[model samples]
Target: MNRKCDKKCLELSFPAVEAEASKGIATLSARLTQNGLPEHKTDDVKIALAEAINNVVEHAYSGIASANVQVNCRLCKERLEIVISDSGAPLPGLRIPDGKPAQLGSSIQNLPEGGFGWFLIHQLTSEIRYERYDGNNHLCLRFDL
Candidate 1:
């Protein structure tokens, strides 16, 4: 990959609601595809981006209305960096695990309802980071080309 050219970045902001969040992911995926990201890697990027945006819609803006989520995508030589930010409440006791798939039980009854998103995000990206500042939550995900 060529890392020599000037870095390029894109920024998008939308309502911190489920509907708009989906649009945000779509827009990001389209932009990435236009920038020469491979189809398989673009699929991974879309999944990770959706997971991150959904987290904000589901967790951050619980009971709140009219809030917004901000997303910034930076294209570097070796990887693409995405930063998702929301003005809602921060998650308590948040942790970014090693990029490993969650162990699942054999039966469907043993499945969990809410823990898969983080695992999927970690698995799809090479790096993950989360922080809370000024009453906002910021999640960063990096995908290697």
Candidate 2:
């Protein structure tokens, strides 16, 4: 875990693996609060960020050597912008997912085990963007503070 922090910006770069993702998310949440992200909005930001990073770990680098996840957060007067980038697989079709909520079935046995990631991310973030260029994928999530 390596980070550079200042009054308005927090930058984090780490390996795109499960353990690192967990620690990175926790560390990011702490730094965000210290950098003045409102308490009420912290959970939203953290959830969205974790989803984004998990995608990079699970889907992006599924069969390839794990790469690094680069996170840059900028806090302005009324908004927080987070850019998470990695050298893993690009999003399918190089586009953002539709983020439809996973269907809840009639019984516990029929319930989905996953698929809520993008939906919750879209719900929590004010804006989301994805770009694939130069063999890298960049996902940006924004929150209105």
Most accurate candidate by TM-score? 2
Q: Can you write out model 2's per-residue Cα lDDT over 14-46, one digit (the tens) per residue?
A: 999999999999999999898789988998999
Instruction: For residue 51, give model 2's deviation from the true position in Å.
Output: 0.9
What's each prediction's TM-score? Answer: 0.84, 0.93
lDDT of 2 at 119: 97
Worst 10 residues of 2 by lDDT: 1-10
**CA lDDT, every prediction?**
0.80, 0.89
Residue 136 error, candidate 1, Å: 1.5
lDDT (tens digit, per residue) of candidate 1 on 1-145: 2334466787899998778888888998898788877777988898889888898888778877648889988887678888898888777775554445557778999876667788788778888888877877788887887
